[model samples]
Target: MAQVASLFTLFTHHAKTFRDLVYSLRNSLLKTGVFTNEKVAEQQVVSVINFDIHLRRDADGHRYIERITECVPVEQEAGYPETFRHKTTTEEKMTAFMETMLEYFRRSTDRPLYVARNVIEYRDGSYVAVHPLSERSRKEIAACLAGPDQAAFEAFLAVHWGDSDEN
Candidate 1:
């Protein structure tokens, strides 16, 4: 349950980051006259790159992100009435948008929390901590678990649970 909560928290954070990036790009394009108006820019942003994140737990009690869908808007012909037209060519705008989104994805994925279940599941020695541990503490725990022998495991117990022989 706690792992699910953490995943939710990270998802929310990343969602906000994605939204902000889209809006910022819209504003920039609007200033540059690439878009005729703010409304059209916003529509393009919504249609171009939208993210949907879901949290799921496997049967083995491992919690993870079930899916992340990146939806792109459909293209329509330019001759339609009452349709939003771009000040510039659609291809150019789309190219810029794709580039920006790619950069954002690169940066976001650099963080451990932003990783998906598929990659994490197959990772050697990967395990989710149910307790609320700081990022540093989690790394330390992983290091301890990765050590060569029983002394390392005992050290982990002593550091994390205070389970020394005296106790």
Candidate 2:
């Protein structure tokens, strides 16, 4: 079988708030092999480990993900290398990354978190991972936007998508 990158969707019931979830995920990912040596930047709604991986929460607060991506080197090699520089192959690295995440989630909370894995695709000259937001999540988000707490809702949007002026 051909090896490919994997993206995981994480669902947690222990997270009472979005901030709590982001914090937990950041700490957990830092302990993983893939992110241990990398610089992890934690924001209000997203945490990025270098440029190779990112952990973020969906807008509706119904989905979370730790995305592991393949980084292309700026200086391209002329030809295929004779052997891998690292002892572990790409597949092995991905396996370890997945295992570490699963173990962390298992031990972090009493409530079981649903984890779904999907292989990333390179289509039409772009990398793509299909993560369709559910209709329920969409309705919930719309309700929030239409509700009285407009200030809080706008704050949430600013944190995730940045301020409108900046955009």
TM-score leader = 1
C-alpha lDDT values of all predictions = 0.46, 0.40
Q: In candidate 1, which residue ranges exceed 4 Å CA deviation?
A: 1-16, 50-167
Candidate 1 lDDT over 1-167, as tens digits, reads 22233322122433333445556757867988879876567666554343445455567998776444333332333222222233277887676667666656754454221211111122233542222323333444466554565467556545654532321
Clashing pairs in 2: none
Expressed as tens digits, the lDDT of each residue in 59-162 for candidate 2 is 67643344433211121223432333443789866666666666556544432222222223344544454333223333445565655675676565545444
What range of 10 consecutive residues in model 2 has the weakest lDDT sum? 43-52
Name the regions of candidate 2 deviating beyond 4 angstroms: 1-10, 37-167
Residue 95, model 1: lDDT of 69
Cα miss at 12, model 1 (Å)?
18
Give per-model TM-scores: 0.24, 0.22
**How does residue 166 of candidate 2 score in lDDT?**
20
lDDT for model 2 comes to 0.40
